[model samples]
Target chain A: MSLLRLRRASLSYPAGGGSVEVLRDVDLTIRRGEFVTVLGRSGAGKTSLLNLAAGFVAPSSGAVEVDGRPVTGPGADRAVVFQDDALLPWLDASENVAFPLRLKGAGRAERLERAAALLRLVGLEGHERKNLWELSGGQRQRLGIARAIAAEPEFLLMDEPLGALDAMTRDRMQELLLKVWRASGAGALLITHSVEEALFLGTRVVVMEPRPGRIGLDEGLDFSARFLEGVPARALKAEPAFIAARERLIAAIHAEEAA
Target chain B: MTVSATNLPERAASRFPSGGRPALPAAFLRRLPVFAALFTLTAVFGLWWIASARGWAPPVFLPSPDRVWKAAQIAADTGYASATLGQHAAASLGRVMAALLVTLLIAVPAGFVLALSPVGRGLLDPLIEFIRPLPPLAYLPLVIIWFGIGEGSKILVISVAMFAPIAISTAFGVGSASESQVRAARSFGASRFQTLRHVLLPAALPSIISGVRIALGAGWTTLVASELVAASRGLGYMIQSAAQFLVTDMVIVGILAISLFAFGFEILFRLIERFWLPWSRRR
Candidate 1:
């Protein structure tokens, strides 16, 4: 079953005297264990689509459903990794991961134990007590991912989760994300402007266009599975097939610009 | 070869031929501001002593440091204006603290409400602005007439003085809570009250604490002024009566006592800010 589905969803905001359409007739879906990436230029409403899936915003028309149930508002079933890695500053690393469990009324010992396990899964085993400011940017993002998965949500919605990181850190995070996604088996819809990242991490990639944004291309690829089968990221990127796919995705985006 | 020759002299000069003095130890550098402050304080006192000794101002008016010291000892041991120095100081402190307690109890929750809800802010913003700028003393006449020159009136005056700063800062703090933090909380399925408790409250705490500190100072100032007009027991009362009687020594003692109390409270607030909100200090 599809973990999340957006059916002909449209979103618009009131601007000056009339409405400015951000997304129009946007249909997307993420089945269980599938890794989906949405690629677009700025103002292409990729984020608006993600917000609709997360139920952070409502569509002006059509439906956003999770597991056949319509999404009316945000719920624990869907978790978001925000662009800025918005971990609560007052809470230390472990406490931040444990926050959602606490919201669900889990006991102290249980939540702490679960949080420590999630932190360890994200490779932050011993840095449990470090404050948010003390953690480097990449570490903060890892903590955000840990917190997102701590609730065991069926779907993870990430909006430019690696956009703030340096190249080396982003590369390492991309590998880590594949490992976590494969292990958790939770469907993911990641939005980004990076073609390399979209190709490397996604089992399926969707390209979007702006000015009443709509999906431009939807393609299925096996790169993420090939990486899982022990094809190293560096080696895969240098392959002629990988290069060709990357070019095709870029061209699809440019086609939207020309249109 | 020419470039090498020029570079050798530049390197040698940078390494060993400097004319500047050696750098001071970190400990001494850190204490430099303290030393400067002490020097300035001592110079002011020395000037006062020299002027008094040279009869720059008559002893009856200025009263030498020795006379003030003697007055302090006398007030501490016997009494000042029918009450000992401790009693007078305590009276003023008690009124300020009482008013502060009332202000905290009322203003903090009110501030949070105003911050969290636009309707609450709309209702309260005008009233807060109107009351904030009017001097606590401006309401003195109305307070005295209503509550009758007693402890009630004086406490009410100080409480009125304190309420504005605490409420304003809390509202500002709540308003300033980062959007990302609030969104993160909501995404985790936290309700509005839970978001306030876990996110907004902690984010706004540093501002709220600083506001309370400002309100304390304002409340103290208003307490003294209120006591001057009505009360018979506080330091302000002692100083006003002593001035009328031309007892310059007693007046000096009252002023010094008030200064000492204010200084002590400032230290206490600083320590609380350091200990309770260490994360706020990091930024």
Candidate 2:
């Protein structure tokens, strides 16, 4: 069954006197344990689509559903990892990770224990007391992911989660992301402009087109499964099949741009 | 890549003979501001002493520092106007404290409301603007008429002086809370109250603290002004009464006491800011 479903969702914003459509007739589904990657250009409304799924923004037409119910507003059931890694500066790393549990009325010891475990999962052990400014960018993003999953949400909606990282850090983060996704057992819908990342991490990839943004292509692949099956990411990416798949995604994106 | 001169290791210093002996003086030079401030204070004291000793100004107008000290001693032992210097200072401090506490309790919450709600802001913005610009002394007459030469009027005057800065800065703090932080909290299903407590309040805290500091200074100033106009006790009343009788030494003692107390409060607030909100402190 689909963990999150968007049925012909459309969004428009009031631009000057008239309305400007940002997303048009977009339909997608994220099933349990699936890693879905969305590829789009800058103005393709990828964020708008993610916002619709997360219920941060309501659709102007059609509906966004999660577990067979319509999404009205943001809920703990669908946690989002933002590109900016919005950890509160006033909070230390551990406190930031424990915030969701704190909101849920968990006891101090319980929440702290859970936050410590989550921090360890994100490979930030012994850095629990570090202030937000003390954390490196990649560590902050990892903290963001840890915070997202601390609530044990059914779906993780990520918007360009690794967009700000350097090449080496981005590669490491992608591997870590897959590991976290498998451990949490939650469906993910991540939006990115990187074709390599989309091919590397996603079980299913969707391409979005701009100028009244809509889904351009949807394809299923097995690279993530192969990577899970003891194939290292470097070896997997260097394989002919992986290269062909990456080319196909890139070609699709470029073709959509031309269209 | 070319090696830069900055990256090169330093050679042995020929001028020092034993590495560098200037380290001590360099360290002292780094503390130049402290010495400069001390020197400036000493010079001012020397000038005051010279002026009085040379009879540059009559004793009725500008009494010597020893005369002021003698007046302080006399006030401490015999009491001035039936109360000691301590009583006057305590009264002034009490009024400022009460007014500050009351202002903080009311204004901080009202500030949050005004910042969070458009309707609250629209309704209160004009009234706050109107009252904020009017000097605290301008309202002293009306306050005295309403509450009469009691503690009520004095505290009210100080409270009025403090309210605007505290409220406005708090509102600004809330308004300037990071949009991304609030959005992240909301995405985690944080309710309005939860957002306020967990995100908005902490984010606004630094600004709120700064507001309190500003309000303290304003409140202290207003307290003195109000006391000068109408009061049996307080440093301002003591100074005003002494000036009326041409007791220059007593007036200088009262003025110095007020300055000392204000300086002490400023240091106390700085210490509180450092200890309580360490994260807000700049590196």
DockQ of prediction 1: 0.60
Give the TM-score of chain A, superposed on the true chain A, for all candidates in the order listed. 0.98, 0.97
- DockQ of each candidate's interface versus the true one? 0.60, 0.56
Per-residue lDDT for B1-283 in model 1, tens only?
1122223544564576435978778797556556776898899989989989999999879889999999999988998899988899999999988998999898988899788889988988898888899897789899888889889889889988998899988888887777766776677888878888888888788778778878887987887689867577999888988998999989999998888887788778777766877677564
lDDT of 1: 0.86
Off by over 4 Å in 2: B1-30
Clashing pairs in 1: none
Poorest lDDT segment (10 consecutive residues) of candidate 2 chain A: A250-259
Residue B270 lDDT in candidate 2 = 68
Query: For residues A1-259, could you state the per-residue lDDT of candidate 2 as single tens digits?
Result: 5579999999999999999999999999999799999997889999999989988899999899987799989888888998999888777898899888988888988988999999999999999899888888999999999999997888899999999999999999999999999999999999998999999999999999887999999999788888888799999999998898888878888886566
The candidate 1 chain B region of ten consecutive residues with least summed lDDT is B1-10
lDDT of 2 at A54: 86
